[model samples]
Target: METQLEDLRQQLDKQCLINQELQRQNKDLEQRLQEKEKLLQELQGQYHELDGPSQRPSNEPEFRKSRAAVISSEPIHETLDIAGTGVKKTVSETSLIVKAIQKNDFLSRLDDEQIAMMVDLLVAFDYSPKDEVIKEGVEGDSMYIVADGELSVTQAGRNLRTLNSGDVFGELAILYNCKRTATVKAMTNVRLWCMERQTYRTIITNKSKKKREQLMGFLKTSRTLKDLNDAQLSKIIDSMDEVKYQDKDVIVREGSEGNTFYIILKGEVLVTKNVNGHQKQIRRMGKGDHFGEQALIREVLRTATCTADGPVTCFSIDKEVFEETIPIEHLELFDDSKVLQETKAPEKSGPSSTLKFKDLLPVLYQEGRHQGDPVTLGVGGFGRVELMTTLVHGKYYAMKRVSKKHIVAKRQEEHMLFEKKILKSIQCDFIVRLHAAFKDTRYIYMVMEFCVGGEIWTKLKEVGRFDEPVAMFCTACVVEAYAYLHKKNIMYRDLKPENLMLDVRGYVKLVDFGFAKEMVRGEKTYSFVGTPEYMAPEIIKNQGHDFAVDFWSLGVLIFELLAGSPPFSSSEPQKIYAKILDGVFKYPPYLSEAAKSIISKLCRPRPGQRLGNTKNGIKDIRHHRWFSSMNWHKLRMCQLDAPTVRLIRKGPCYINFDRFPYDLAKAEEEFSGWDRNF
Candidate 1:
């Protein structure tokens, strides 16, 4: 009986252990089943979101850019309204502009007629993800009024800020005729309205002078020129006088005495100096540029020599003229006497006396109104001419764009800073306006006033050559712009067809300042520079010269305008140099005797013998028999009519097409690398 009882107890203990093990196993299985059910439900939700026509893109993000196209690839969907009806609206160029302007202050201020005219000029644009809207350092052609979505303003590899609807850029460059300070990139699908400089000038000129003054007042508040006023703006415009320069023409000689300033109306100029006994090129200048302001401010000798890189045009102004005409407050910015009294240099504080470009850019951009879309007219080494739009308190403006990389060489940085100085100091219609600026590590953007008619190069090429009277009239306009620049002590080095832009009314605009440099007093430069075709013999020989070189280029430009080809040329650069050294100029049979005579006087081999070599340099050129029909005083006031009327012209190149292949590739690679980082 005891053995049987012991066996039963053992069996009962084994059964109890088995029961506990089974219970634990069953609980684990139940938990796993619950987890499986949860996963299945989550997958079902994902399928519902992505399985149909409403599915979003697989690779594109929520805010990706799209091309400006007639047809869109987005998924289509039907919507049901409360009354079982649906209403839809399609996007159009006019609608896009309306949307963009409604968000901005300046464009919104325009009357219905003005707004309609602006809308008529707008073209539609769409952007893809990572598309660059504006390049840094180049003059801005257009201001973008975002219809929808977002953009980012970047500089030197840093994100400065993001811009949205109602935010306008490129106005600072347009208002000031300076280089762009930042790069703008589209962050999402963006629609923008583009306006050009020509349109804006036309609209303003059509208005009464009082209205124009009001407009000028609106532009003066920009931080870049925080101190300028309406009277000063008018004086700057009135003081403009155009002068021409040829390749290798000396603009300002080192150690020479001068009290004038210059703004580049056209072409390229090179700044060179002896560094450690070796002559080196420090910078190059292009159109809408300025130089030699130090001489204008004080009794100082020229510090550097400037020579034309090609046939160049400039607007010049003398210091005395400025003092007499410009408002006292406007003169105070560069007035040594006033600046010293208000805030002495070498001190970083006190009214922020020493101007740092970086600190001033934002204020300029913020104060100016948003202009119109950048008009597409032409492209050159300095980049594309884009139409832009601007706005102030819901009113509209027009602008142009200049690229930094296109003008400044890879090695030049300080040259760009100098260019900004020249552009910001003056305001005029003959001069391309500087509205706003932006930049990035790879490029710079200059927002400027847009001109609808395109450049003089295209016109000349289309028309072949101009008649004698027409040539004189055109030349007169160029000379006026140059007079303003030279009077300011600015040297425009390059003067070529590529740099002379024109508006609808055939008003010439000198643009590009990639090679511009500042000349302090008593400075001498000794650098070999200039394009082969238009180079002056003295510059080629490395002999020093001064502003008289501009007259030489003017002679060459006149010859070209009258005759199809430049006065001197050869098959090779070496041969061309030889011809230039020999001072060989030929007048075609078609050239008028008066025109030929003027060319001869302007192109004299000796700087002193050139038409504009004397203290009243331009006076001689103006008095030349070719200008016998012109009234100098009336011409100065733009009382004479333009020889030709310009029609809307399409840019020579397409924006969708790649102009800077290397840059585009680099930008792509950089963005891809960043994608990996993310």
Candidate 2:
């Protein structure tokens, strides 16, 4: 019995030992399971980081390189597309990725999570109806996509068309640092989603250019561009730029040279031109319409000018690509009869011809009777405008000679063309007749109608202020000339006394198209290309503008003429720009209500609020009390005369004309106007 009991105890001990070993093994297995779960969680977190709802791991081989041999392979697009199948699917598809990566319109059409990601990539803008969205001839730092409402595009003084919903603008200026092509205006209260040039650069860096190219390829499948070949279409895509403008803004100006073409991806615009000396609305354009094609061809001056009818947006193309992609051969086949009627040439090139200035110099000199002399008109960074005179048959004619150095530096080719085309086409006493532009490898000569009385700038210096009659007459002439140019779809950006040449009779003859541009309706351009003192606030900010700029300039000119200085004069251009943005034109103590009213209307900050941007601006000015005794119809005929004459023995010296290698570098260091830097 004792031996049997001992055996049972030994068996129980053996069983207990076995149970303890089994429990130890089970605890070890549980610890290993927890370790596996932690590792899996870490892996999942890493995967989420790489391919989140907002971002995805690109198909770059480098990204796929790590742990490739161990993991199962899966295409990123296929995986994301499948995973995001229905809910918020639009925000996850490759198309959204492409759009988001490009910083395109993804922000405008995103789900809540996707919007949060996109909001990180945008700038916001709010505008009231008819606000100027962009200005022509100003440099731009950003592009915009409309989040809501309507816009119009304009060139010169004509309304092109209207744009609504999902439109993009301001891309061209951001892309090339070129001038704004057209003015964009809000047709209704609107909001714009903005992106800067830096943002675009970031996108390009983030998504390789090859991916961008691929995306563009996919986009070209849209119907509007279906007719074009892939190569030609790609050229257009590559050349695309963006611009924005406000209602009644002038886009392109008639008679100005342009090196840009535009595609109206969104917005409305109007086309207008001087038809038989009248501001006539010829046509209107809208989304999918393109303009400035003439620039893509031979460097012909612009024909009709355009203006924004409402807030507008557009994508612009550079001239090089625009020229290469478009069918120029088709343009040659264009029936000129459809564009312009055959007008009889004036007998003996009265004031209009395509002849060189030099060729016309000898004839005009011989017919007019005068002695040769050298005189300078302008100075400073722009160099000078020197009168190169020679006597022929007792008549002396002044040929304004601008050196190649100055011409090339200031990029005056477009300006020269503007003066030539419009001035040549019209015969107006108040308008400076631009005879011809003669180039001789080194020097550029512009044969101008001799203005022996000197610049109007000097007149303001001589007399503290002009009497009402004198001021009215001079202002009227300038207004008429400006009206004509605007009617012809041109905007003279640099409007100051320096550019206002006077004929022998002291009649104000508007001169210098150096900063002139043909505005297209419903188009925007960006270029920081104008003199600061004369620049409008919109110009300084790189917002698009139109013919309304002329009105602002006129307001400044009138104030200067009356008060002997501009209301916003300052040593700093920034200060001046700020003042302009403030939209205040301080009236002198004794100014007339009529003059004040006109200036106020003209200087309004809102392009749409300004008299000039409105269709009635011209008529409104015409009916003002200051012009109560004036005749609009007769003024249009250029029959107005100057009330006083302050003639100099000779015009100013050519020492001021655009030139270099002269004593100017030292002289400019001394003089105020000449010394100032932009």
Please name the candidate that would achieve the greatest lDDT relative to the true structure. Answer: 2
Per-residue lDDT of candidate 2, residues 1-678 (tens digit): 999999999999999999999999999999999888867855675786688622422221011111100110111121111122222323333243335334432223222333443345555679999799987667676777676789998978688777665566765433334457678899899977676655443333233333335435543554434555443444345335558889988889888888776666457888888988887888989776777755755677778888888888776655654443345554221234532442232323454444534434332111112223323444434345545444433333455555555444444545555555665566666667765556554455666666767667665554446667777777888887877766556777777776677666656788766667787432333344555445665554444456667777788777777776676655434355556666666576667888888888677664444555543446666666887877767656546555656433343332112222222331111122221111
C-alpha lDDT values of all predictions: 0.55, 0.57
Window of ten residues with lowest summed lDDT in model 1: 64-73
Q: Model 2 — TM-score against the truth? A: 0.46
The backbone clash count of each candidate, in order, is 184, 107
The regions of model 2 sitting more than 4 angstroms off are 1-373, 409-419, 633-641, 646-678
Scored against the true structure, residue 675 in model 1 reaches a CA lDDT of 16
Tally clashing residue pairs in candidate 1. Answer: 184
